[model samples]
Target chain A: MTAESNITWKANFPDSFLWAEWEDEEASVFFHRGSGETLLLNPLGAYLLKTICSEDISEEKLAQRTVRYFDLPVDEELLSAISVSLHTFEQKGLLLSSASQ
Target chain B: MKPLDLKPGEIARLLRSNGLRLQIGPFAVSLRSRLRRVAEQIAFFYGDYPRIEADAFVDFHIQINNPAGLRHWVRPQAIFSFDGFKPFKPLPEDQAFAMFEWGLNWCIATTSHQFLITHAAVVAKNGQAIIFPGEPGAGKSTLCAALVSRGWQLLSDEMALIDPGDLSITPVPRPIGLKNESIAIMKNYGDETLVGPPVTDTIKGTVAHMRPPADSIVHADRDTRPGYIIFPTYSAAADSQLDKVEKTRALVRIAEQSFNYHILGREGFRTVERLVSRCPAFDLRYSQLDSAIAEIDALL
Candidate 1:
């Protein structure tokens, strides 16, 4: 799948994820965990994770929200790029396609 | 010979056996009971008119006639139960040693502790402990006990001692409290180290505990940086796995787990805030001990 695909993901985060976090000290990874699939979330991925939980939407909408919150310059190129990233996430089963959800 | 009303000498003897040196209020105690562990250490006392005191650490204290009558006393200030296997068959032992440990925990917690007391099993490695603080049957203690065979050290079997001053978790690798099916469950996962005979009926079916591995008890007082605070639940239908969770949420969850959160009040909020800012938190839903160990080890 490419980034432009318009689908919403459908994976439920567990209760323990309430205070989940990730930080890099000395370039290493550290994050809280729950009793489900361990979803590796870096800064951008974590931001997206929070955004999706806050509000579910299509890839187009997701890109728009990212731009709105993070102040990324909105453009077709950026949207397409984000869509591609989201597609990879769907393939890995980290997030469900909005349509499927 | 009431459990809660301990003679000073009894308290000192326990600390001496465990090699723990402690001073409570004005009572000073030392013990060497660290080498052995039992199923349950309950200190029973009687009195609504006269109260008792001790400088010792214990497991559980029973105020037969609480001096603070009519009050639903929930939390304790100090405690120091061990991970020794003792059975509660036939009849029960004095367990005065266990009583002292629990009493001390109550005293300390009431005096300076202002957090909730959750029935969880916390473990640590490299001075970093994960606070698996949750309610009964949350599978916290069960999962925690299983990890011992996998090399994870036990930080506590019941409460997560959150230090308000530093916001770091104090090490409390007490006995791994097990109840009902858990007692048998531990036998299946690792070499059985039964504590006391099962205390039947009360609640959670037939209940018993397992002595934590030796290393865990020896380092019971050692402080650990709170690294991960997970709320785990055991589901038999599946293998174990770890899920990533967030901060403001962790704050709320910790608030839920506090035994005396309201008592701790503003200081509690500040302490929790510090924890949220520094420690990693998660929501775990797993059934496999091996899988849990591998995933948790990665976090470490």
Candidate 2:
């Protein structure tokens, strides 16, 4: 999946959803009640989603923060996974571009 | 006074005239019906519920009347009215008891938003309520009836009421609705006197309602903290097992089973989140009632 060009991804209308997050043995779990969707995310994805929800942040900045938050070496595979998950969230209507906000 | 306090003839007259006012947990209901059988069943089944005064406030005003037409003469039919509005088309007259039970469920599920309502059967033991959320034919009511027979207090047999403020479960104990094989199964296991005769060929395929225990109805104001959420699925081919459900999946499933989860929005989210965080959830499958009862009893 690919995010649209020329727009920054964020949870522009987070209040329209009812959400909760908690840690499980397997992974961090997030539930969006308005979409009836449950997403299992690794630490990196969880931080990205949580940041986007609470702050006005761009997807590029979110990617940079994930690496710093995890204290990991910058890797292409990690960035690619975050990009795909962000695109999925956009398709699910959980996130929208800043231009549409 | 209880409905059973009046004689059968007197109950019929009261229902026909001023209607029967009764306190059903958090709601006061006034039921009016001209049909004698409706009066008899209500007196027989709801005998333990406290009667309400004539001047008391009523949450729902419901009536079942024989429709005024030739169909009432030819085959006989009943129409269910709620607060002066008929929400359903007429049904077979003999299905009046089933109609009343389903109609009242609809009223509560539709109107009561202060509490999050789930389509689940709930019972409490040692002051901890366990919710069994299931679809039709999932044997939820059967499991609930078995638990209630084993001295567990029935909170509800169809809807689990969760207060949005504290995430506690309030008791709205009503009759346990059993269908098809469950009717005979409950009758064989518990007192036959507690189970009404099966109403044949309704939309749910031969439905019967078992009277809730007297204590459950008497102490209907009691609410319990939620302890567990179990999804019970009955299959003759599968062995009895209780598998732990991950908290995240459990949260989504409960919201899916709830009638007002989406309507309540943020409050609904926080309620389920708090509930799932505190309680352990499981996926329970059973072929026999005895094993199921034993396993569930061990959960407490």
Of all native A–B interface contacts, model 1 reproduces a fraction of 0.00
DockQ of each: 0.03, 0.32
lDDT of 1 by residue, B37-152 (tens): 22113211111011223444543322211123233244212223323222122112233333444444554455444343444567888878887878778888888888876778
Q: What is the C-alpha lDDT of each candidate?
A: 0.55, 0.85
Candidate 2 lDDT tens digits, B1-300: 453477678778888998888888899999999987798789888878888889999999999989887987888999999999999998998899889999999999999999999999999988899999999899999999988988999999999999988888989999899999998899988888999878898989999999999999876888899999999999997677999987777777887899988788777777887888999999999988889988888898
- Model 2, A15-55: lDDT tens per residue? 65444566545456566656756566666667777788887
**Could you give the DockQ of candidate 1?**
0.03
lDDT tens string, model 1, A1-101? 23444466544442223323324321111122322223434455666666665656666566667788768777777677676666665665555665655
Best by DockQ: 2
Worst 10 residues of 2 chain B by lDDT: B1-10
